[model samples]
Target: MKILACYSIKGGVGKTATAVNLAYWAARSNYRTLLLDLDSQGASSFYFRIKAPAKKNLGKRFLQAYGQLASQIKESDFPHLDVIPAHLSFRNFDILLEDLGKRKNRLRQALKGLKKEYDLIILDCPPTISRLAENIFNAADIVLVPVIPTTLSERTFEQLLQFFKQQDLSRSKLVPFFTMADARKQLHRETAIAMRKRYKNFLQHAIPQSTDVEKMGKYRTPIDLFARNTQANRAYYALWRELEPQLKKA
Candidate 1:
């Protein structure tokens, strides 16, 4: 199975939106897609209208009962795509993973049994460089880094590259893209130009900032399903097209 993680060191850069749209495109293309919500806030789960179970102090129990957690994920109410909903229980995941002394491979181990069931797996990661994040990096075939066209966002992209370099990973797997772009702003234009110049081959299609993308939250649907005619939807379709060959080969 092809595993892709949509991630960013900094939040509010449309990582969840990218994951949701990409998962929808993969499923629409007749691939068995699964989107795992790894963020404790559960935004991806909420966007897909999957309500996480209400319980406290369940994180430790979940790690101890990994099989049951996997089963619950498989039985969740997502149509063509399966969802592994995240809850408040996930907040302590980093601690549990570290305590187990399998910090770097915890997520990879948890996902071992799911390889045969999905053609594509998209992980919605939280914005941090923790052990869980390292596990995601180690497990994914590709890490899709979404950055807004700003100096701070560009710095975050550089930090991500530095992290990858430290891990001794191939830079080819680091696909960076601009999200929430506004052409009217000079900084956005300048930043895009700089990024294209520095990481030409690593750059993917840009996703423009649009109200339609934000509306997906209220609609609880992917942009492809909610507003196909909108600019955001078309942008995501372009991004999906760029990703198609890589996914198929994986």
Candidate 2:
């Protein structure tokens, strides 16, 4: 399976939204997709209307019963897409990961059994640069870095690049995309131009800021499903098209 991790060091940049929409599009295109909500806040799980299991020590339970992760897949109702919901238990998962001493590969080891079951596995990562995030980088085939057209977002992009440079990875697999963009803003226009000039070949499609995107969480549906005629839907469709060539090769 091809693993795509939608991530950002900073929050509120639409990483979860991108993951949800892309997974939905992948399923709609006839691919068997799996959306793994890795964020502790459970926002992605909430967006998909999946209820997270209640328990304070559930992350510990998960690690102890790692083999059961696959069994949980049978409970989801989306035809071609399955979801692994996140729970509040993950708030303490980081501490457990640290105590385990090999935290960087914890997620990688947990996901090895699922490689053959999905055509595309999208990870909705938490907004942090922890060992869990590094594990995601190590496991992902392609890392889609979402950046807003702002100075703070640009700084995060640079930090991402620096992080990648320190790791052993295929640099060509790093794809950058603009998220929550307002084209009419001078800062947005300037930032986009600068990003294109610096990372021309690695840049993917840009997703403009729209209310439709924000509403995906409220509707508990993807933009493609909720408002197909809107600009947001078209943008996500274009992103899927752009991603097709790379996905097919996997």
Candidate 3:
């Protein structure tokens, strides 16, 4: 399976929305897609109208054990799409991974069994550089970072790159795309132009700041399905097209 992680060093940058939307388009393209909500807040699960994974079956012991996650997978409303619900217990992932053997690749090893079942695995990761995050970096084929065109956001993106270099992870896997961009805002337009020039790998499409994206919370669906034919959807489609070459090979 091709693993893609929607990750950022900072939060509130449309990371989860990108994951949900990309997974939707993947499924629509007849690829068996799985969206794994690793954020304990369960926002991705909520967007799909899914409940958090029950506490009775979750804890550090269970979460750390390889291959147990497959048991938590739930089918989504759409065909060829599925999800592994998020749980508050996931907040302890750092501790869980800490006490494991070969800690760095624990998540990667657990996911091996899924290669035959899924074409795409889009991880909606938590915002932090923790042990679990290292597992994600180790596992993902491409790490997609949703960046807001602002100084703080850009700094955080740089921090992510620094972390990758320090950790000896493949920096080539990192792909950044702009989020919440407003053309009317000179800061947004200027930053977008400057950053892309600085970082050759930055994605070309920018998702406009829109209430339509926020409406995903109320509608409990992806932008591709809820706000059809919108500029927001158009940008998401274009973003997916940008990643298509990599995904198509899988």
What C-alpha lDDT values do all the predictions have?
Answer: 0.83, 0.81, 0.87
Give candidate 3's total backbone clashes: 0
Residue range 171-216, candidate 2, lDDT tens digits: 6667889989998999999988988888765456789999999898
User: Candidate 1's residue-wise lDDT over 1-250, tens digit each?
Assistant: 8889999999899999999898888887877888889888999898888878776666666655557556657433445788888878777778888887875766766676677787888999999998777888988888888989899998888988898899887777778888999999999999899888988755567899899989998899888776988889989988988988976664
* lDDT-superior candidate, 1 or 2: 1
Instruction: Give me candidate 2's TM-score against the actual structure.
Output: 0.92
The better-scoring model by lDDT among 2 and 3 is 3
Residues 1-250 of candidate 3: C-alpha lDDT, one tens digit per residue: 8999999989999999899999998888888999999999999999999998556537464455545777788999999999988899888888777766556887877787788999999999999898889999999999999999998888998999999999999898998989999999999888889999999988888888998899999999998777798999988888888887865553
Rank candidates, lDDT, best first: 3, 1, 2
Q: Which of 2 and 3 is ahead in TM-score?
A: 3
Cα RMSD (Å) per model? 1.9, 1.9, 1.5
Which runs in model 1 stand beyond 4 Å of their true positions?
A: 55-58, 61-66, 74-79
Q: What TM-score do all the candidates reach, one by one? A: 0.92, 0.92, 0.95
lDDT-superior candidate, 1 or 3: 3
